[model samples]
Target: MRSLGVAVAYPDPGVADELVHAVEAEADLYLALDPARAAVVLAGEEALSTLGEHPADAAVVGVAADRDAIAVVARAALRCGAHEIVLWPQDRAMLRSIVRDAATRARIGAGRAEGRIVAVAGARGGVGTTTVAAMLARAVAESVVVDLDPVGAGLSGFLSDGAEPTLAAVVAAVDDLDPAALSAAMAGHAAGRAICAEPREAAPTKQQAARMLALLRATVPVAVIDAGRAADDAAMAAISLADQTICVCTPDVASIRGARALIAAAGRGFPVVLNRSARMRLSAKDVARVVGAPPVAVIPDDPAIRRAGEAGRLPSRGAARRAIERLAGLILAEASDGS
Candidate 1:
């Protein structure tokens, strides 16, 4: 496993026990305010300026003098990307909740940046992980690509050929694969770009999956696996191998609750993309409250995407396309910054 890339800055050791716990054994924190460093821990509004010094992925906590000042601190903390802001008046219970939320967002943003492996799974069914995955697959796939879902799921039909070449072929060629070779095996997009979306009820084994993913990454700047409904060990392994995972959910209570676990299961990092959101059922704020972190991006309920799938056509260059393209840019930018 890669090191948990984290950076934390706390000037005072007032809460030494909690400080140690915040770092966690597996994570490598960039503690900015330690005595060893010439760091002076700033408080409240001043801390926002310090954000540029910290890695974009690091979770920051702004310690204030008291609870009453927390709201003021939190506003600045949000601007600084300081995930959480805390006050001495508060106890661990409330503080921990706030801190955890910020830390999780920090982790998620960082994870997705480096071609993060993500599994877009629906809570139960009909939650649209497939469609979300298919659109996202096109969004991230640049050079080399891998679509884990099988043909006939619109990914194959609309984005690429259903029967020509698939991720299955890439898996078969794993032993001798390189970036160029893997790129060759994927299905091509509108601009002659390639993708690997082979549907198999039994996905590749974990080790096999990892090796293939590693190889695919070597050739393609991005590799997207459409996990489909098969959220098995192999699929989980694929998701784990990813630098970040994107859990797709709807606004319904069931989808929200399921998305919560899916995001959590992806570990401390990985963004949650709310798909087909319904304001009547639940708002983005409601989803955020459930998931604890604001969704990296919220996609509205658009039937055109489904219609495009049924017609075996890529989503038109309309509202959905504009949103998706922008979403793609955000995802790619995040990838470049290692967020």
Candidate 2:
């Protein structure tokens, strides 16, 4: 483990001394003379204005005098991008934990090659975006899925054991998000790992969404994000960050119309996947004509897929699995070429 540099700034002389002492007590922490170069910054209310000068990834702590002062500085600290607020002398242990976690993330991200990001979004609700994203991730080696849907069946419910420290906890601590924090939030899946969304929880801000994706890029070889219908900031952020965006829709008229609208709204045409294409009058060419892009993959409706998903796994041998495997190969090839 690498020692992290910490810079402290407090208006009160006594509080400043205590903070310095606390930093010195930690073997993995050291005082830095410059705030811009430090890995962690301890800033008082008066010092909040200078936070903008520090690195964007730097862990910022707002020092509060007591419980009363916390309320006064909490909103301001949040606006100034402080990761957490700690009371002097009382929350020393919490401060140590925050700094150490930041250090660990910094060490892990250092010199790591950023991974390929793929976003799968539905033309409308119930178009199988989560299924496609999860299956594609499963087909690829060393991949992880992220659920950015704000109001849908959670990805973990079907793929994972519904573990704690979910996306709700991650967005709550977005500013302090690190590789370790993200790893803790993930639920292990047979396909890979997943950060499941909490449908009832508030959506992450654009900055929070971007930060999460950036951390994922640093932590894994491939990240597949289920953007649902791209109705929220997190979904939009994933689409924007992805190396490839796959727009999934069925062969029905409503689904094709929705895909057209979504593509128009995005101002760019994404590769289309005609999912559940069966017994419909519209063909792949018809969808291609309407969406302005040829269908990249057409997955047939398979009952086995639904059964396997309900059972918390993907179909082992079926046409659905074969189609998903082909899509995964295309994504991997694109990622390799881009790399």
Candidate 3:
């Protein structure tokens, strides 16, 4: 096992000495010269001001003197974004345990490859962006779908009954975000997990959106973001981070025009998926010509898919399901090749 680095930031020399002694007592733990390089940072109340300078992935353990000091410092720690609060002397064992766990997490994160992110955006509303995102997530192994759309009924309404600690909550804690915090915010679904947006909640800022996506990339094998139409800052943020952006649109004049504009704005060719294909006279080639790229997948207008969606489930077997599965395979292949 690799030794874990511990960094201490306490205003009082006596308290700092105690912290250093506790860390040195463990054979696996060693003092880190740079706080940013450490797996865990032990900070006293006054030292909490330096929290912003450390890496967000570092575990922050706030140290307080006693029960009385803990009460005062705990509240301050929460505001300053500490992950945990430890009482000096009394919680020495707990501190050691926290350091060990943090070390394990840091090692795992450093060893594993970062995940692929796919952003699904629609040419316009009602073009099946959410459906494509949800189905793609289901087809991909060890995947999660994130609902970044704020206007339409969230992706959770289509997949599950939406869980607590929504996207809004996650964005609010982006400054101190961790894999554990994000995992708790996800809702369970037969397809996979989802971080659904709360209805009518304010959109995430660009910084918050970027931070959330970064954490997701570090945590999951793959993440599919339902970016709606890619109109707002949050949607653009997802697109900016995505390894691939799938543009979904129907084979119609208006929809094709919208898709062309989106493709042009992207300044690069993106794979387009023709949703509800063969329902109109426009063929895949016609739509592809207008969109400046070939249709990667054509999902037929399947009644089974509609029926399954109405019941908040995906079609077990159908042409549409097979097409989505192929798309998922392509995404996985591209991600692997990139790696």
Candidate 4:
């Protein structure tokens, strides 16, 4: 919500009213003369060069005076990530219309906004990947946890309140997406978080999964994909699009082998999670040795985790609660640093 910097090189006062009103409507843009705190710059010949400019962080809204060619502005806008351009209109009504459209595009990139993708996949089935995913989602703020299970054992029953969640309905509706469609696909869990739980009775094609993940990142600031047990080609594609991957490993040798193969094969990084710590007959260090990195986190063995998943909330309070909080903080800190 930083203020937008607007430099009007239009050289005419005739269309000033219309242009000013247009930027006012959009909350994303703040019209401030101070160069230090601008989200966007309306650069023209005057002070533009003096501002020590060459694509500083702000998005640029280029305006040409008395020239009502928006199509020209649109091309330049896309290139520089400039949101919009308002041509000075002698007609007040036309100026208002142009500014409104430009404001809409400004919402796409904002510094305070967080853009992230974290995928959770188990070494194999029944190792608590889904439970950990729900926990991770619960820990983050303003984020969505999607159970994109292509094999489609829907995540609905895990919630304490039996709300049947299906992502298929939303995914099926979108071919090309923007922010608006993303908002529609998400539903609130009673536990005060959002989840996309869709039944995948028929397996989703690799192409479908790839497209879904692409569109999800296009709009939301943070996206958490929960890949239960096996990671199909589609799941692997999801991992490739991730900022990081959390591989849920138990202390069994077979699980460690599977996790190692997954890490070696993936395009990005793997952050190991040793779930259910106490029951593991093998040591975490031994397991980490196989996976190639020291385990980044270990969620201790706790029955409350099952209760957390069943209630559709992460284990907010537990014997191992500190570990969960630490993992959440690590992810958040990584995301913030990325910002």
Per-residue lDDT of 1-339 in model 2, one digit per residue for the tens?
Answer: 357799998898998998999899888889998988898888888788777788777777888887888877787787886767788778877777876554445433453335778999999999998888888988988788888886884586654565542788787786776666677777787567887876666778888888788787756778998899999877888888787899999988899989998888887878899998887468899998898878999999999888987787778888988999999998888877874
Clashes of 3: 0
lDDT of 4: 0.62
State every prediction's TM-score relative to the real structure: 0.59, 0.67, 0.70, 0.71
The local distance difference test score of each candidate is 0.58, 0.81, 0.81, 0.62
lDDT for model 1 comes to 0.58
Worst 10 residues of 4 by lDDT: 105-114
* Descending-TM-score candidate ranking: 4, 3, 2, 1
lDDT of 4 by residue, 78-136 (tens): 55555555555443445433433333334333322335788888887777777677667
Error of 4 at 299 (Å): 0.6
Sum up the clashes in candidate 1: 20
Query: Per-residue alpha-carbon lDDT of model 3 for 211-266, expressed as tens digits?
Result: 78877776678899999988889888888778899899997888888888887877
For candidate 2, the lDDT comes to 0.81
Error (Å) of candidate 3 at residue 221 is 0.9
Total backbone clashes of model 4?
5
Per-residue error at 127 for model 4, in Å? 1.2
Give stretches of model 1 more than 4 Å off.
1-119, 140-145, 150-154, 159-165, 190-201
